[model samples]
Target: MTAFIENDVHAVAPEVAISFFKGIMPFDTLDEETLRSLARHCRIDFFPKGTRLLTADVTELTHLYFIQRGGVKAFLEDENGEVTLKDFRGEGAYIGALAIIRGTPANLNIETVEDTFCFLLPRDIFLGLIEKQASFAHFYLKSFSEKIVTTAYNELRHHKVTRRSNEDLYLFSIRVGDLVKTLRKVAASATIQEAAALMSEHRVGCLLIHDAVDAEKIVGIITDRDLRGKVVAAGLDFQQPVQTIMSTPVQTVLSQSLCFDVLLKMMDTGIHHLAVERAGKIIGVITSHDIMLLQGHSPYYLFKEIRGQQQISGLYPLANKIPDVIRGLIGEGAKAGNITQMIAILNDHILERMLTLLEQELGAPPVPYCWLLLGSEGRREQTFKTDQDNAIIYSDPEDETQAQAAAAYFKAFAAKAIDHLVNCGYPLCPGEVMAVNPLWCQPLSSWKRYFERWVSEPDPQELRYATIFFDFRAGFGEAALAESLRTHLNQHIKGRDLFLFHLARQSMETRAPLSFFKNFIVERDGEHKNRLDIKKQGLTPFVNFARVLALKFGVNETNTLARLKALRDGDWIQAELWSSASEAYELQMQQRLVHQLRQIEAETIPDNYIDPADLSDLERRMLKDAFTVIERLYGVLDQMYPVT
Candidate 1:
């Protein structure tokens, strides 16, 4: 129905405006005096259903409309006049904040979905509030994203499980610099006795060895373990140069790196101590002891146990305990990203150990190669229910004899690796995408040809392969091979606009599990009756959307969050849209993890289906909101290349 604002109306009372503002956020954060000032300037208007309150054609937004009653639909309209719905916002939601704050036309349309009563704050008042109120300004800028993330984990805050010593906060929020106490260094020419004396004097666990010529340049490092195992135990002369005993190539992390990531690095590299660097210079050192002190029951112990295990049978029990550790982290309020990264770290350790054992049994390969992880594993976003999605990429062989030998060795290696991983609880990829498939285990040249064919000759089958293989990352072995393959893949897809268009269209094939009225559209019948495939329907859209844009723009990041961040920083996408997509992805991931965790706790095999009936009211709202964010992202893609 065509609509208009009521021409006849009484002026909105200040008390009424103040009352409404106090009930919502940002405004509720304001002081009473500031609220009164806003109330004094506010005016009310009633618009009939289908009223075009704002649109892309407007030169500038005149007022910020706060929905006092009823709701509105915001959407984008492309040059072809095809509309893509962005969201259904109800009471407490505001419109024109983006346009007014930027002094630009509305980037999308906001129209009344029902008979809507709105409290209108003029552009001048809104700008004045923004300039004078820091909290109010931050809300429009980024606080909404915080609310989105924090609200999603509200259930975690109230979980009845036994609480640990705030380990989640320490792991995710504390930086490496926070734990590093001091930097202790010695010249490479210093005697082992002098290094030991320095360690004793400072009461330190390790000492960084600097270059003999350049005092500022660190050349190596020696820890207490090295002093005991290499010097004391081996009966080396105490007067020998420390360089003879020092372990070359010290591990270092930036001062700002998270404790969680530091722990992962320590566990993965089997290092007890790491130098902490700021800019390019080492400032201090952090030990695994320091991290473990923050969380005495952390995964460091489990990782140590995994590293010490000699056989695959020993890893099975350890692998099963991982879900419990992750659940405990979640119960303590760790974010989805941190949880997944921790899972990936542990999984990587198991894979590394399994490969090492297998190599010992089968002998070394004929050529240098990398075990490439694809899809979620590649992105380091593994959850409890992950399967093997891997491939093998080896160097080009010297000759036919060499080629045959290389193929036979890796063929056996892949089969053993896959079997060992399955024994350790990682299921086989249903599609045979794992390295065990001879089709996927290939030399560098073959892998390059595969990517070129997939990107250049776009088709349903080819794009399917593109979607999976494009997210490859080297999990183990020679990383250079994987890096070279990534370079080749990115170069091939560059400037391939048609391929991107087809990819984007294919990405949208699995529609969000949302309906026209913003209700969840679940399965009609079968085992998943009344449930939705959260992984395929809720999660994959975000992954695919980011992949298409990242591919088009040559973003080399494999992780969804990182790709979205690159897109946002480059202004390839709107900052607000980036926040929405990121928060949405995290929330859905949290849902998926909690669901899988419950299944594991019940001793049942975990899957992706989520019943709307199982979610709390807030969770349901968050899920619906996430689905809306996915559609908005799709709208952006549609604007780029309309899927006709």
Candidate 2:
């Protein structure tokens, strides 16, 4: 390996090295003085194809190499000699930073894929820059999760008018612990009057109730509203134990949790207070007010308004506020996953209120039923534009007359509920896959039969149904029915390898839209010419692939991100592969969301189509990287289940 390498003194030409470094990131942020210093210390080396630059366990990495020309392949080899490809680094890509920074031997076997030229910064020079330059060091020191999100966010901030300044944006970065200034606790045996008096004296709106037997053990929570509603409004005795009106079990968040996540949790659960804990000990309390005080706009308020509204007419306009809330969250640098979860929670609130109003007007349900949120909604991945993909699963009927009654009541209930949702801006499902569709709205027994048949008699058409229906989650009603149905579905598919093969084959049908030259394979001529269907080409492959693997492993998570995490946790997928796939999914989601927001601003219907030409150079490059990751992910599926 040393014999094939040659040094070139000309590689450190200050002007050329500075220019090249300026084009690549982190280095691009550096001052001319630092770049010159780096150039002066750097040496360029040439290696022939098949040259081993660094081998795991065999070589110690001494320098960080910035690829100037050609490429290298990084992989791992097990004791059995089975190899796993890690990544391919080309021009503008760098290597050995992770190893050099961590002061460890190379974890990957790095070899030149072709005759390659690289500018090498010695260990001393690398460490010097890491210590002296904050920005350059941050790029490498940040965790992969933070790096991908911040990279996309910084790009967004550069392109858009993000209303919040850097300082204001920092509010979202504050942890739950940082916001906890007080921890008020009351014994469960305390009278309601005494608890309210303590709250008043302390100027607190809520108190964490601890067990009389174990004062440190938080048992329940009682808020100002609970005093007014559960005590005064209900005409309960003021001397009654606080436990009479207190709610259990107390909601708690880790001290390390972001205030942004805390706000989302409050909104999702319709709660106002959360206990903050550090190292398993309750330390303080953080409320919605504490988080809301940091920002002018909050979805928590909007979520509250939706929950308070009783009439469908009033709820109609609240749905329109979702886009503005999403925009505010994006401006505040909320992550793609958090934003999607917020959207799902807001949508669920609106639907829940809508159904409640229906039950009031049309009378209570005739039988216990579960309202199923299917497809993207079920996965909690809704964006700006989504139509209804819902279903209903009712309990088994007791008799023919009861069955007739349930059928009539739900038929009318689903149609009216869907109409109200439509008035609130939800479009109808294009495939008629909503609660109002008879095929989708059925008894629990029928749903079980549907899954059993689909699993045993796997076909392309049934696989399509499996792709959508398999992601069902109970949005409302008896959730037990949904859980029972899931158990039944998993049971039937437990030993069914052929079903998994068919599902994998279905996933393979949609390939990444990249070509041989690494350019986008977009339509040449049409209304959508030069535009890529971001959903079908970019997002579907991930959704499909995650679903396929989740099914094969009997992982019950419905969300793509959650499924990927479960797979990684169960050791079903490699950690590196999970990281790549997760980052790719998130980056693509950010692109699609920004695109949809732009369309909404233009007063046009939001869509999944994105024109690569319209994207900034940074976004386009990241998107291409995401696409490359997707293609590699499919390779794993291919090796598992070869589609002939």
Candidate 3:
């Protein structure tokens, strides 16, 4: 079906020439002769600011816009006249190909963001070019991906702030010394009257009360709220020592610690102020106000909002807002691990609450049982809501007859909890790996038996089913049950060369889809033909790689990054290897998340498969870099533990 233009389309005028589209994408993929033939039909057009570039209802979208200068924004107007900005194109970009190729009226209106200049190629010519170049054809077919990058770029523009570096944006990178405005120090023995006077004089929210014995040591803190709640409200004597009203055992953070993690400490403990310590002495203080002003809608706000929920039904709306929060954070350049960790934390609260509510309805568990989160959720690396991989472990019953009754109660509780979770947006596990499955809802001793059997006799077919169990961690309930199992499993597997080798061999079975020629190895056929499965091919390689190393080192950390860090700290892995592998894993996760969000926004089922051609040049290179790192790591693993 090769399309050979009948002949070069002669320029309608001097301004319409083949030379116009020389370096533009898609056009760049064209050979000189073909490129010239198509460019002959291209005409340069100017669009003034506020001018309509394209109308949504136009019966014929005759032009394919390739921007040469300035900018244009595409928007979709829905019912009730609400308009959502869809995409933006600047110089070296193109638009209108999707609508023109599909032969459907585009549900978008393009308007000039500024006075813009573009090379317009007629719709008929563009289709002819698509048939001529496979690369050019692919670029247009991945409209969703192209839309995602443009939308993300627009989001970044909308939220861009001046006078802030990447370090300033990340709470974890902000040092306590960098955030403090002033240090107000006071003696612990200072009278409440004197403290009130100093507070009034300084107009500060809190005072760093030093220890009576060691002047350099900050023993407690007193805030305006403390004075109001403890003295003014409770009717305590105002003349008494400030220590009486001051909060003892004050929360503190190292001066060099990340402000974001420290903020989490304050939020977790309901502390308004935290003393900043440098070396061994008090340096300054950081208040909730400081973080609030610096970080808008911090994780603390989300944490409080999640925990404040009193009913399961109320969580739906709040949960819906989470995607916006994630998208905003990603736009602002937050790390993928940190973003996913925050999500996993918030999700834990929702699931734990659901379980608590179910307990109230179904009556308390017949025995102490731990609700274990497995797979990505267990690893705290869940970027998208896929399906719940969970199981329950209960105390072993004394009598064999009692086991049946206890299992039934737990199975019922698990079913109710899973049903509620599904309502809250977590889909049911397609593999039937959830706790409601009786095979997974087992007594602690039974779980031990399951692990021992898998380790002792490693069957590849059986290993696939039982392997993810190693990543399990207690999400709620009696954590001791999960803890005991982890200890038992680790002790059994440690130094078992055969078991570790088998695990490594099994993990090595999946390889990152990076080819020697530096092109992605995509699906050859089926529904996702020619698409890259970033999860199974990209993410799973690192997940499996890290799990093997963790088992080798007896590391209990479930997170891929955490496991790598533990290995690095133990001097078991080279620093360079750790950095590259970590970066590669993060890049893959971020790519998957970005792609999944696009699917969700489009109201389609979110998936890991992505069309590489849709990615901008920069993104495609970065993807290759990430895959290259994974390939290198696999080479090292193969050398160390060769398969028979």
Candidate 4:
């Protein structure tokens, strides 16, 4: 195997190459000597087109290759010489490593489609190096565990989809303990009447003929309809092989396929049953009945219900059913994130209806305006008991008088809508930050002035406005109005280092809810005495960190999670940091959901505060971990943007 020098490999976009190395095995935690040794063993080799590096039938492997450039395709060929493409590997991926490590023949044939350059290391040398280097061994084990975890997660998600589709199709796999019909061996020349008698004796809807050693590889299936229409109706001889009338070329799916995908296939083809295949062998059959029964209530009906609501009052009933809808989605095994997104969509529709009704009650606005959603609503991460945190932005007025008139008109309209939303189940914003607040319903110039004042001369009181108002997402109105405001803010905040520093410092002000000993830090005294303020302690920190990064990076995205992802993708923050922040956000949101569910159960209004006594030990630990992530992120931000 050819080896390449580490310096040569590092020469290509060195920083990114180093990052990729640090993220993977061996190099991730290698000592200087181990790193040097590995680098010495690593040789970069080039393969021309049509080169076969590994074949399925190859019983031994001496080296593992890591692709540095170009692409390779791994495929399997059947007896008929038809090749099935399994996977494609390119840069930053290991090729033929699994077979080399597992000491098995390659499950797939790897061939270069074009000229490819890769780092090669002899299997024995790499194994010996890993054994001698503790850090290398640790990194390898961790990498393997992570891969297994990721693969398991993907499989679980796939299975969930399959299980849900099974319910929708009203299909069920026969259990070993259940009484099932058993058929004796039958030759291809077996009489049709004899097979019919056996099927009748078994009292089954269909007959499975066993011609091969593997009973599951059913050569033919005879349903009652087939017997009646093909045999009895035609007055055919009873002493004929069942295969003569059996359906040929049966369709099949791998057990690994998602259920919903299978359901879609069945629906498209107008077929009920699909044979389950693994490694080109049939195991069992999944029927349409199985899929239908497994599928829970469809969300399409809910969408239709929302669309059919004519007035604001009509939305009240649907809004009330929102919790049930979420519960149904959860029951159907929808991912928490996906369920939240769907709920947000439904909430948007309800809010839209309220806006429509408000517009009818109070005539159209005097000036072009846009209704803005703030906080979680703006982020589309709202739960069942979200509050109204919105504002209105109209075009700059021709004069002060016209601006006042436009602001007043929007304020009144917002107030009406807020009231409708309250009646529909959403509580009014506690901070009075809604559009109904006279300070919020303003012209474009006034909004810009508000933002400029907040940015140019930052104050503790105004910082609150900056945090919430900065996250404004267009809920309703002229799209251009919001865009113009966004453009203005983006332009003003780009080089304003002081503003960013202030934002970062302000973000760190919210002390994480854990004490020195890592115990819960309850509220000192208030209406929520002895309670943990989840919003103030958990959610706000992540929100602040994301906001600071967004401002510094001139990222136009408003949603906190989106901002975090954008920053990570833009290379502003490391992936691990982004992942930690995201996990913290998700954990906090889940806690908030639990709190909301409890409130709904008790028929009480949900709030951000939660009593520590109510939390389980596991939840308390997760909460602490979430806070720690935020605390670390705050430290990073502090270092990046030091206080003046």
Pick the TM-score winner.
Answer: 2
Per-residue accuracy of model 2 over 432-469 as CA lDDT, tens digit each = 99989999889999999999899988888898899889
- Cα lDDT of model 1 by residue, 189-250, tens digit: 99999999999999988999999999999999999998999988999999999999888798
Q: How does model 4 fare in lDDT?
A: 0.69
1-644 in candidate 4: lDDT tens per residue?
32222243322343444544566655677555555555655566677767777878674666777777888887766467866334677877776555665577775678887788777767987777667777666555556435433332222233222233333322123221121123333444567887788767865555555564655556766666788999999998887777787665567677666554565466445555566666676666665555544535544345557767777788887888777556544434343455566677678767766787678778877788888988778777788777789888888878878878886787678777888888888888889988888888878888999888888888787777788888878887787988898889988887888877877887888888889999889988979899988877878888888888887788888777789999999999988788767866866776676567557767887788988786644356566877888778978987998765
RMSD of each predicted structure: 11.6, 12.3, 12.7, 18.4
Give the number of colliding residue pairs in candidate 2.
0
- What TM-scores do the predictions have? 0.75, 0.78, 0.68, 0.58
| Candidate 4: 10-residue stretch with minimal lDDT | 171-180
Off by over 4 Å in 1: 1-138, 160-170, 173-190, 198-203, 208-221, 233-236, 240-258, 268-270, 276-284
Tens digits of lDDT, candidate 3, 235-275: 99988999988888977788888776676576546677888
Give the better candidate number (1 or 2) by TM-score. 2
Rank candidates, TM-score, best first: 2, 1, 3, 4
Which of candidates 2 and 4 is the stronger one according to lDDT? 2
lDDT for every model? Answer: 0.85, 0.85, 0.76, 0.69
By lDDT rank, best first, the candidates go: 1, 2, 3, 4
Error of 2 at 257 (Å): 1.3
Candidate 2 global CA lDDT score: 0.85
